[model samples]
Target: MLVFFTFVILLALTVTNSKQTFVILKKSREDWILDGIGLFFQGIAIPFFQIAVVFQLYQLLLPDTRASLNLYPIAAFLLSFVFVDYLYYWNHRLFHTRKLWFIHQVHHTVTEMDVLGTSRNTLWTSFFIVYLWIHSLFIYLLQEPNWYILGISLSSALDLWRHSSFSPTVNSWLYRCLSPWLILPQDHAWHHSQFIQGNYGANLKLWDKIHKTYHKSDQVPDSLGINSSLSLSKKLFLPLE
Candidate 1:
């Protein structure tokens, strides 16, 4: 699936450029070298940040769960994942609108699209996933097991895909046909395009369609950011836009 979607998207981007333009775009190698470290630290950061800050407060209101019926854990885990994805749809659409674009614009500023581009985002951008709060609320409300861990895993996987540039999956008919339901590179490219209305939600495709923010064209283009003067990498400072 990844290969099929990544290929079409990469092909679309290449045809748009007549060559792979992002290959020449330069960001500091120091930035590249530290990505794994960043990933590791961040792996620990948000959970600690949220658990220490939020979940601890949550557990205070709950009865003892160390001996409770654990069967609910699986249902809670699966349900929480879907709800998080669903709310991400709204949070993402909001970022595309004028009210939230400033934060999101920071991310699209990077003219270079690569795996490293995933980690180029600012710290506050992490808060955009504050939908984790929703996960927290449900987990606390239900006191399910391992909800927190599932949140971390699902979020990390989605974030990894957001910055992955060269997927070969987009070439398949199933990918294109299902593009409206899933966010493939074509949809992401539209969000990253220079033209107006390209910036929309990332994880879910239907939100853009329902909200009338979707951008579609038979021919793809070369440029990927707003025509701004600031360094593109600096633009990822905000999750809005």
Candidate 2:
């Protein structure tokens, strides 16, 4: 519910903001096809797969540990928001490396900041992401995962927001509060910039700051995304450098 609400709000903001709306209007047919397919696969298929296949697979592999680890609500939340977040930070950074860049480059092909492009990636790229495995494993192991689920929801919401052009005004109270810790849209724009060198954390800037990959900037990059010669089919299936 929260994630949906967040998406609606962000979409509304994107449609209303002239600059963002222009970006949306400029989207090509191929962009729509890629993003639409990505959205359906990420939003629908991924969840269903997690519940039906991944969770069941975990049940078979760790039958004795199904919902066996009981934890306090706060502990479970922290486990997802902090521990898993840290793990994904490294996982995301690894995607930028030469060996894995081919699989991840499709996502960085977006030329502008738009929510629709949030999930843009090769179809099987989710398998390389830490969330698919770690999130399912934790949900299976934790006896009560409500708080953990909430954490996931919040993280997912942030992902949507950071991928869009919706951002708090600079120097505003909201910006001041969130910019110090959270990964804002502008922060993420740097990651998707033509350079694509730093700011790799998904939810928090702590990991990037700690690792010296955080690029502090008050302005969005003039140029965004990488130019890809790969066709839509190749991008969706086998994106080779």
Candidate 3:
């Protein structure tokens, strides 16, 4: 979920690429609506979802338990976010595979990169996330701290970075200062490429590499969109089915 927050940074990166893209977004209704909705869901709704799932997990872990204003709950939240991002790497890849592409193609339908471009996803993707179940499972198993909720919050907030068009200054610095421990804009953008038969992890490229899904690139993509046919209304509603 915090992976979702990093997307805002990705949006900033996209804007820095050129003023023309910003000008174009300012004129589009979809951009405005998508940003508004994405912000709310990622901010308010996502926290509520986390809280709800954490509460449920507590109850399941101790069927007769009542929560204290304690630290353990927060720890559980943090552990959940860390684990989810790892699982999400593969889940995101699954979305791009044969048969599954029918769902993920909706996200790729966006032909451009921008802040709003991240919202171009099939609604069903949400259901597939099953955030509550996964979060609950992590809490039950890890018995992590309540303070860890901070990580979950941070993870959701930073997800904005994944969809941004912004290139990094560290293209040269990453190898020295960073390890491919987590996913970056360039890694995610690879998932949106016209040739996306491989490299599909989000939030971490290391998993992609280990899984033999990694691809190296020197530039941000010049084009993006789904390879299949779709209608606007269908794209919005297909997730329901």
Best by lDDT: 2
Candidates ranked by lDDT, best first?
Answer: 2, 3, 1
Across 1-241, the per-residue lDDT of candidate 2 in tens digits comes to: 9888988898898889998889889899999999999999998899899999999999899999988999999999999998999999999999999999999999999989899899999998998999999999999999999999999999999999899887899999999999999999999999989875999898889999999999999889998988999988998997442
Runs in model 1 deviating more than 4 A are 1-25, 29-42, 60-78, 146-152, 169-180, 196-199, 217-220, 227-241
Q: Residue pairs in steric clash, candidate 2?
A: none
Instruction: Give per-residue CA lDDT, model 3, range 110-138, as digits (tens).
Output: 55555565655555455566454565444
How well is each residue in 147-171 modelled by candidate 1, as lDDT tens digits?
Answer: 5446546555655555545434555
Cα displacement (Å) at residue 162, model 3: 2.0
Backbone atom clashes (below 3 Å) for every candidate: 26, 0, 42
Total clashes, candidate 2?
0
- Predicted structure with the largest TM-score when compared to the true one: 2
Q: What is the lDDT of candidate 1?
A: 0.56
Give the lDDT of residue 65 in candidate 1: 41
Off by over 4 Å in 3: 1-23, 26-39, 49-78, 136-144, 170-175, 227-229
Descending-TM-score candidate ranking: 2, 3, 1
Model 2 CA deviation exceeding 4 Å by range: 239-241
C-alpha lDDT of all candidate models, in order: 0.56, 0.92, 0.59
- Give candidate 1's error at residue 218 in angstroms: 6.8
